[model samples]
Target chain A: MSAFRSLSLAMLKGLLRDRTASFFTLVFPLMFLLLFGALFQNDSVSRSHVLQFGEVAVLDEMPADQRRDLSEALNVEQVRDRDEALARVSDGDADAVVWQDEDGRIELRYSAADATRAGTVQGLMQSLVQSANLAETGQPPAFELASDQVEDKSIKPIQYLAPGLLGWAIAMGASFMSAFTLVNWRKKRILRRLWLAPISPGTVIGARIGVSLGMAFLQTALFLGVATIPFYGLRLTGFWWLAIPLVACGTLAFMSVGLVIGAWAKTDEAANAALQLVIMPMAFLSGSFFPLDSSPDWVRAISNAMPLKHLNEAVQGVLTRGEGWGAALPAMGGLLLFAAVLTAVAARLFRWDDT
Target chain B: MGPLNVSNAAGRPEPGATRGPTEALDAARPAPPRGPAPPRFGHGYHRQVTKNIPAIAVEGLRKRYGEVRAVDGVTFEVAHGEFYGILGPNGAGKTTTLELVEGLREPDEGSARLLGQPSWPRDPGLLRRIGVQLQASAFFEKLTAREQIHTFAALYGVSSRRADEMLETVGLTEKAGTRDDKLSGGQAQRLSIACALVHDPELVFLDEPTTGLDPQARRNLWDLLREINAQGRTVVLTTHYLDEAEILCDRVAIMDAGRILRVGAPSELIAELGVGNLEDVFLQLTGREYRE
Candidate 1:
């Protein structure tokens, strides 16, 4: 009884001791709420321009002649030179830049200063180019878009930023916590010591799972508490209550992945890197940064395998679409499956020490 | 069937120089009498006492990491109550072998038994019977010695109201409240040993127990370990200091590249290799080659 008590206390103390980890796990996801809440509402960016880079950067290297047509863009300035244009845009000397690539394409570069404004710019440019592109000419000539009512589909900064922040909290909380602790035990050769005793490997893994799961839940709660403020304010109605457990469950699901990473790597750094390897691409693809609904179908499909996709989708349903766990059940189910698989793998592959 | 096995360290390789007496030392220094003499292992830990039924039976132990064969076809056994040592240079699969024996890993090709039972059964009850001190261990950084001891003690279903008392046993009573991460290397090592002992295990494994400690600390650990052995518990220890092994282990095995080169008492191993000391025997068995 005392040993289990001590184990729980020890695990908690370990979490509290890591200042940086604590901040990331307990603070940052909701910080985005506060930061973005104050910045990117429709009223906030009523007149801002949208810059579409991946699609509209085509004019960046267009011959000086074709570039001349882009001056008509909203807050539109087609900076004639790439480096100078980039500098002005980067330093806020210009609201945005418009350029085309070698393929006789249309492109836009907006100040990344305000992501909301950037998204607004991105939304504006995408619509403008989509409606006016003259493929026969192999370029979209500069044209003023005159829509009395421009459907402003620019995502709120909070909505855009929430998924990635949440995903990071889940991935980081689990990965680092497990990796460092696991490898250190191995390096120290403590597991081997435990082995000479009658203790089974299952007990060791169960204890670790209990420890990491508790931490995972704590990470979610911290993020939720921080969410109470406005920019990061809780946008959900009663349905949000349902998403709470879903999100918490998602956090545990992701932590299981971290456990696997920790179990597989021989060194602490390797374990950490292994976690990032799993996290970075998944976070980007799983709509953690932006809604993947607009992304290609295949891209969206890949996200199904990522824990963050389910997590962000859960958040999106309750917070954005005003749905509940019933709506997010598919993603939640996927998360549970992922959790079960990862836990099994971590347990199966676990080593007692750094052998 | 035993006190909680909180800190039993499984064995690994260490240097065993300045060999002890071949047969005479078994009867040389005696304090507390041990159980009936254990039979020799499949081969032996270090010397040929005899081929005894093993308390730990390792058959064809093997491990692989992508491109590296960490442990390959290594086979050995450890008799109950023997002060066994596995001696080898760094990266010779000694630690890997120990991990397999301890049931941390599943054998890729072989089988291991702990007291006549398959070790991979994942029994919590089994851990309560062993005490271990690892080679490169870590504890909860902010946990005071008292806290760490109590916590680990609970995992194996044992309780010690005296975490501080255990610390005192390890000569760390004054520092019991300090966080483990703040302890000096030697102090940390002491606390680790204390963690392994708080539950009073019957079989204790110590992997490279004195790798980084100063001479005084090493000597202190040796005496402490001797005192532990005097309690009639089996001690399976590993170290790089040949003199320490010679002085401590009743039986020893020389391993190189995941294979046991020889096994006998320190003196017997040296005699078998026809060398003057452990270093000579080691040199004769394995020429100077940097093994990382």
Candidate 2:
């Protein structure tokens, strides 16, 4: 046990001292979170949409009270002229433009660049105008539509992106870090020297995996605390703490992949090339950058086979979807199985010497 | 040529003698002794008092790589506290034989025992009692020499202070804080030796410990190794330098074509071959042609 601890401490110190590895393991994932968080800052349900109101000749004839109520209900911003409102709508500075035509009918002009936002603005305007018409006629409506959303709050893009990013951080940190460090040590015959010692091979491999798992947990906490907690207001639900084990299994799985590459590759360059080939596709196809719901069936099929996909799903299920341990079992099981099988293969093929 | 008895001429010091570092190093700087003597085993009446337990025993050990036989039917025994050297030209299976005895490689046939324990089965406890230094060692690039030795010492359940003592023994105390990558080749070689002996193993295997070192560094290492042997430890070394073997080894084995052509004290091997030195005997046994 003392030997294992010493080896683990030595490996951790070596990794920390390597500036390039520190950047990738500790700093790069945070950079991703900050970049993506800022990019999707406005993708929330509570964001206010701008409605530019243009000067209309017929507005003077309508009752002042009715016009005031309509304007307030629409959240309208008064513009000097139609031309200005049209320019604002075209530039996407406003969600839509509202004007009263000569015939006294309200008309709206909106950009189709973002169809969802355009439709939302149009629906809001229609409801406000209908209420105005009822008030003008001085009639009490027979039935009123009182609507409430079933979900507590709308799902934000960051909610989905945070878990995926966390998964990506773990995959990259474990796989690339393991592959590069292992191959470099093998090239230097450091592994050979360690093997010549009294320490068991299992202890050496355990120390490496333990370090990677430690990094994985650090990445999970960092991405969650720095990005998810502040920006997305992440709420942990039933069995939320299961994320810790999920991350461990996921990290071990990817680290085993790295071990296989490290054992098979003859040089550092080859290991790096193989790592990139594995990591890039896994990150993308696993929904690290975007949702895979709209992707083609074959892409989804490929994503289903990826360990990162399961990790992202399990994390997002508990964090964003508020699911329980039962919901994350499949992903957790998959990750554990992957870790076991790949670790076995890596152990079978592992060689202390370069030859 | 006539048989020569040069053991006394080598001027080996008695065990446990106190000497300054400089004086101890100077003791190994004598000129190579010449002349030949008949093969001798367990010389003089001392043979009767010394126990006969061999530190290392190998019988019909063999290892093959595809079509090449790296170690073919090799056999030898190293008695306790003997400074033994395996000398051969390039590709003479010297390293393969050492690794087989060190438990780093599995032989295709036959057996090897170290300190009465079989080399196969690879018992970690057995490895704890042995120390090995490969020809090309790789250490953590960022760890200081002291830290590297301390780390290995911890593996063997040895005290961390042993690292300091080992460094002092190898004459590397001044460079203890230098990282392995920054050390000169000779300094790194000394560091490797220090790490190998950090656990105070009963048996030590050094594969070409002085290969790339300058003359002074080589002599210094020879002194260190002799001191280690004097402390009642077995030393098994493989080297290409004939003079190094002739000076340091109590018994030298000249190997060629995966077999030992001769095994005896340096002067006795010279006498047996009717040659001027071990180098001439090696050339005569293995041929003058180059091997890649």
Tens-place lDDT per residue, model 1, B169-226, is 7887777778887887778888888888877876677888888887656756766787
Query: Over the stretch A175-221, how does candidate 1's per-residue lDDT look in tens digits?
Result: 67766767766675555544554445566656666776776666556
Candidate 1 i-RMS: 3.2
Model 2 TM-score, 2 decimals: 0.81
How would you class the docking of model 1? acceptable
RMSD (Cα, Å) for all candidates, in order, is 11.9, 7.6
Give the worst 10-residue stretch by lDDT in candidate 2 chain B.
Answer: B1-10
The whole-model lDDT of each prediction reads 0.65, 0.76
Q: How does model 1 score on DockQ?
A: 0.35
Model 1 TM-score is 0.66
Per-residue lDDT for B98 in model 2?
A: 91
Error of 2 at B73 (Å): 0.6
